[model samples]
Target: MLLDTFGRQAVDLRVSLTDRCNLRCTYCMPEEGLQWLGRSELLTDEEIVRLVSIAVTDLGVTEVRFTGGEPLLRPGLVAIVAACAELAPRPELSLTSNGIGLARIAAALKAAGLDRVNVSLDTLDPEVFRTLTRRSRHQDVLDGLAAAEAAGLTPVKLNAVLMRGVNDHEAPDLLAWCLAHGYQLRFIEQMPLDAQHGWDRSQMVTAGEILERLGTRFALTPEPSAARGAAPAERWLVDGGPASVGVIASVTRPFCRACDRTRLTADGQVRNCLFATGETDLRTALREGGSDAEIAALWRAAMWGKKAGAGIDDPEFLQPERPMSAIGG
Candidate 1:
């Protein structure tokens, strides 16, 4: 493992295939999306695979996740997954997506060795979904969910962002929907990741409050923390049975101390944390024909300088220049 100065080992890597997304969600990007990186600015599939090889073989990374504005927007997504899966001592592969075009490619993705997926679906109400995402693609998302399950993506995780007056009232209904459909649901507290820099904690619904609302309808017991201590989400078994749910309390309860992941943006920058201000340029070196050793060294140096926490609660914490869409979610 690549150990940092704080004694934290980097064991997970999130690679953004592309910054382009099909949907324009209110919380993620602007109504008129920001200018996207040109095709030449993004990392080629081969370049991405090479980096993943170094992360797994040299740095001892055991898990890799693909994230994007919406990963499905990448035409070469399955091919990318295949390349990563072919790595010697292959790492576990997963993806996070908006699920807009997923229905069309779900089976192909599974055949390419994608182990699992997390689909971001905030509201189940069609009109509410339209209002939040600025698109009427809710049915497409639902179809994608069914397709994923049919394609054998077991325990298909659903990620829902909790906003105060937006979709927080449907917490129970969402949970009910997931439980009935054999989907594992996770509620994440809204963070300062919007392209508009309009995240207001005062208008955010916290993880604790979500749990309170959920508990009123169903019994929940905490899973042993030791089993998933390093994971971002705190999981629980709903009704003490087979069903489960998770709450990512990034705001009220920060898990920075145990964070073991780093991110690579679609534009080829390495970020130690999601909220990192400083970025190490890897694309320039790759395009300039820098050898594997040179690129790997640069990556190690960046990780070595990672801060202990994101410090979202700090008074001086400024919103990151890139939003979740540009930063790879």
Candidate 2:
């Protein structure tokens, strides 16, 4: 496996298929969505599969996740998943989506060889969902969740970004809904990834606060962080049964030390860290007909230079030029 300077193995890769999204979430981007990359700039499906092949066969990556402003927005999404699935010594394939158009494509995606998915559903209330996402696709998200379950996407995880006064109070409610529906819900701490640069550390909800609120109504036993080994979410068993919950404290409790994932932007820049200010331009080399070994070497060099942490707590920390939508959440 490719290991960074800090001894963290790069085993997971997030590939952004497109920078276009269907919804403009309050925490993700401005009401008016930002400009997207040109068609020619984005990596072609064949290029994407070639890179994944190198990662799986050469770099020892075991998990391949497809992300986007919303991956479903990409027309060849099913084909992409199918390509990744064809890898020898096949890697686990998953996706993280806003769940807006998921209802229509969940079964097809599963049939295309997707193993699982993590849907971004911040609220169960229609009005609140509308306010957070700035879209009336609230029911669409719910239907998508149902569709995911029907498609046999086991453990259908729900990712909710918790802001101080916005959806922080709904932790318990969200967990209840997840438990009832057999969905594993994770509350993510709001990070400085918004396009509007409106992330205030003080206004962000912490993992401790979320646990406290949920503990009031549900008995949750904290699971060992090492159980998942570099997986972003910290796990917990809720109500002492099949129910469970997770907290991704990206701000208050950073897990950069054990981060094993690297990212590839839709436009083909390789990011070693989510908050890394710089990127290694793989697109330039790819378009110029760079060999697989050449691209793999560039990838290795980028991973080798990865920082010890994202440094969100650093006094000198600066947000990336791209927002979460552009970066692929």
Candidate 3:
């Protein structure tokens, strides 16, 4: 297995299929949604498959994740999932989505070989959900989750950004709801990906704080799952059933030293660090008639250049200027 500068072995990759999205989550995207990437500039399905093949075979990446401004917005998402699943070794393939249009395509996704789904749902209250995501149909997210479960994506995951004063109070209630429904709920700390999107350091909630809150209500015990890559989330199983929770400590606590994953943007740029300004333009390489081996060399440079840590966790470190939409989350 190929390991990056940090001790992390390269096992997982999150590929952003499109820069376009259906919902304008105020935190990730501007209210007026940013400009979408031109069709000609995005990575072709063949190019994406080649890159993933190199990653899995050459770099020993064991898992590939499909993401985007909302990965479901991409037209050939199911095909992309199918292609990734066809990898000889068959690394774990999954997709993360906002779930706006998930109800229509959940079954097709399962049929296409998507192993799991992570739906972004922040609030239970409709009005508050509208305020956070700036979208109606708060229940649509729940419906999407139900559809995914019915389509055999059992124990569907729900990813919630635990912002202070917004949905922190609902942590216990959210856990209870997930327990009843048998969904794995993960709470992520809001990173400083977009400085202008009203991200306040004071409003941030850390993983330690989240564990404390859960411990107050349930007998939360830490699990010994392999910390394979840049996934900062330390997981725990709640007292009773198969339900569990994960804490992604992006801020207040950083996992820079053990960071492993690499991200490919919809526009075909390899971003080693989410907060880094530098990007190797693979679209240029592809367009300039670069061969597969040539493009693979450039990818190697990008991997070797992965930064120490995302600047969000350290107050002394300068934060990333790029918004979350431009970079895969």
Candidate 4:
């Protein structure tokens, strides 16, 4: 197990396939975008599979989530997912994407052993979508979601970040659409992970405000805390039973104490936390002919030094140099 000093074991691993995205979401990166990672810098398909295999067979990682600037942009995604699925003690596989090209590959991914998906869809309005993403691909995302459902990706999840004035009022509408469409909706508090570093605390819509907006449309009953386990989202039953909604208040309601996740960048760097400033380079070790046991030990050491919290509430908090796009959502 990847055990930290704080007694949290990392059973969940987030792997970034590439630092390239098709859309330019305003909250994640600038319109022009940051310098893309060189092809030679990214881990090869074989390297990714080997590391993930080690994490599952050697280490105790039980869940593997493929993330990216947009994972669908990776040319070898289906093959990677298929390889990872063949590992002993196979991990539950999922992906986090912008859903730009998901419509075309949703079936392929499902057939390749992908268990589910979490696609970012901030608003239902085409105009709002175009304004936020700086692209007119709103219909593509909707089609992608429908494709995911048709492909049997159970409980297809939608991740939405609510900005203060922009699309904040659409909270209720977003929830209604999710409930009606059988998709799990999670509203996240915008964090200081943008490449522009223009995040303002006051300008973010808090979890309280989100629930308050949602209250006007649907009656929500809080799920028991005991049932939440290590999941980041705090869920509530919509109208008393069955369907539900969730809030990932990473800024307002930190769940650091119960965090069970570890991250790997596209370059094969181990990130202990989402806001971590330091990284453990496993790629170099892998390229240098290090044994699997040696690489696993290095990963274990990195997680052991994870900070107690993200420190977003600290007086001297600093945003990570790498934006969410590079860091993998």
Candidate 5:
């Protein structure tokens, strides 16, 4: 098991298929975008499957989520999902994407064993979407959501980040749209994970503010604390029951104490925490003929050294150098 000194065992694995993304969201990167990982630096399909198999069969990872600059952009995504689904314990599979090419591949992904998907969508308005993503593919995203639902990606989740003056006012409307469309909406607090390193706390929409804005149109009932478990989102029963919304307050209500996730970069580096300043390289070891036991031991050691928390509230907190895009969401 990937256990830390704080007694947190990692049961969830987030693997970055590629560091390349199609859309350049303002919160993620610059309009021109940062340098992407070279083809040689990225793990091959076999390497990714082997590492994921090790995590599931040996390291006790019960859930596997594939992320990237945009995972849908990967050519071998469907095959990768199929391979992982064939594992002995058969870990639950999912993907986090920008929803650009999802419409064309949603059915293929569902048939390939992807259980669900979480798409990044900040606004329902096409113009606002373009402004936030710096891309005019708002219609593509909407079509992707519809395709995902049609393909049976049940409880299709939407991850929305509210910038101070940009799309922060759409909190209620976004939630309302999700409720009407039978989609699960999760509002995430923008953290210091941008490539530009220009994240300002004052400009961010806090979890409290999000709830306050949402409260204007909807009556939300908080789910019991015991029901949250190690999940990042704190869910609330919308209105009365059945429908619900979630808030992933990574900056405000940090859930590091209950975190069960371990991350693998597109290049095969182990990231114990999303805000970690350092990484453990498994690619070098894998390429150097390291045995499965040796690789597993390396992963175990990496998780054992995980920090207690992200420390976003600390006076001297430093944003990660890789940014959200490189870090796989």
Candidate 6:
């Protein structure tokens, strides 16, 4: 295993397929267009494949998750997943999407060997959903869920960012709906990753509070299926249903001690911590004709320098300068 300075293994890479997305969520990106990477500046399919091979064979990486502004928007996504599926050790490959175009492409994605998907959804109210996502189609996302289910993508994960007044009340209904749909619902604590203002604890609903709310209707319990202690969420059986609810307390309860993921931005920067001050720019070196060995060396150096934790709730912690879209949320 390729262990970092803090002895965190580089077993997972959240490779972003693209930095362009259709929606403009309240917490994700500013509505104003930001300068995107030019076509020539982005990593080629071959380069991406080579990197994945390096991560698997050279670093013993066991997971490669595809994330993005909306990963499904990437033209080369299916091909990339196919290449990842061909790895020797067969790292667990997954995708996180906004589900805007999923209904149209879910089947093709499944055929390309994507193991599972985490769909971002904030509210069940169509108008509120539109307000939250700016210009997204709630119906299309709903269809995307249906299509994913029909395509045999079992345990489709729903990622709901729990904002204080925005959609916190949607929690109970959202969990109940996912239970009926056989989907896993995970409530993420709203971190001020790229927020307009620095993250405020007042805007957050803590995991303890969430569980307290859940206990009213459902008999909540911890999960045996949690990955030792890596799972930030405490799982629960909801109201005699087969479905379960999870809470990822990233902002309120930080998961720094057991953090196991690294990120590769769309522009090819390597980020040890999402909230780190800056990234090691592998893209510039790659575009400048640096050798694969040299690029790998940089990757290794950055990994070893991983930050202690992404302090989302820390008062002194400055918000990342880069937009969430640019950094591949």
Write one digit per residue (lDDT tens) for candidate 4, span 188-267. 99999999999999899999999999999899999999989999999999998699999999999999999999999999
| Per-residue lDDT of model 2, residues 1-329, tens digit only | 67788888899999999989999888888888999899988999988888889889989999999999889899899998998898898999999988888889999989989999999998878998888888889888889989999998776999998767777888899999998898999899888998999888888888999999999999988787668678788888887766678899888878888898989999899999889899999989988999888989999999999998888878999999899878876
Q: How far is each candidate from the true structure, as Cα RMSD in Å?
A: 1.0, 1.1, 2.1, 0.6, 0.7, 2.0
Model 3 spans > 4 angstroms off: 195-197, 225-230, 240-242, 313-316
Q: In model 4, which range of ten residues has the least summed lDDT?
A: 25-34
For 77-162, candidate 1 gives per-residue lDDT tens digits of: 99999999999898999999988888999999999999999999999999999889899999999999999999997669999986
Clashing pairs in 5: none
- Order candidates by lDDT, high to low: 4, 5, 1, 2, 3, 6
TM-score of every candidate relative to the true structure: 0.98, 0.98, 0.92, 0.99, 0.99, 0.93
Displacement of the residue 122 alpha carbon in candidate 6, Å = 1.4
TM-score of candidate 4 versus the correct structure, residues matched by position: 0.99
Give the Cα lDDT of each candidate. Answer: 0.90, 0.88, 0.80, 0.94, 0.94, 0.79
Give the per-residue Cα lDDT of candidate 1 at 245: 90
Question: How many steric overlaps are in each model, in order?
Answer: 0, 0, 0, 0, 0, 0
State in Å the error of residue 90, model 6: 1.5
Give the range of the ten consecutive residues with the poorest summed lDDT in model 1.
Answer: 161-170
Query: lDDT by residue for model 6 over 1-329, one digit each (tens)?
Result: 55687777767788887888898887776777556779886788777777778778777788888888788888888899888899899988888888889998889888989888888888899988978878859999999988888887766998898677777777778877887788889888777665365556776788887888777767875657554466567677666545668888777667777777778888788887777778998878877788767877888888888778886646688878876776765
lDDT of 3 by residue, 189-226 (tens): 88777626567778788787888888889988677656
lDDT of residue 312 for candidate 1: 91
Q: Model 6 reaches what TM-score against the true structure?
A: 0.93
Off by over 4 Å in 1: none
As for lDDT, the candidate ahead, 3 or 5, is: 5
Clashes of 6: 0
The regions of model 5 sitting more than 4 angstroms off are none
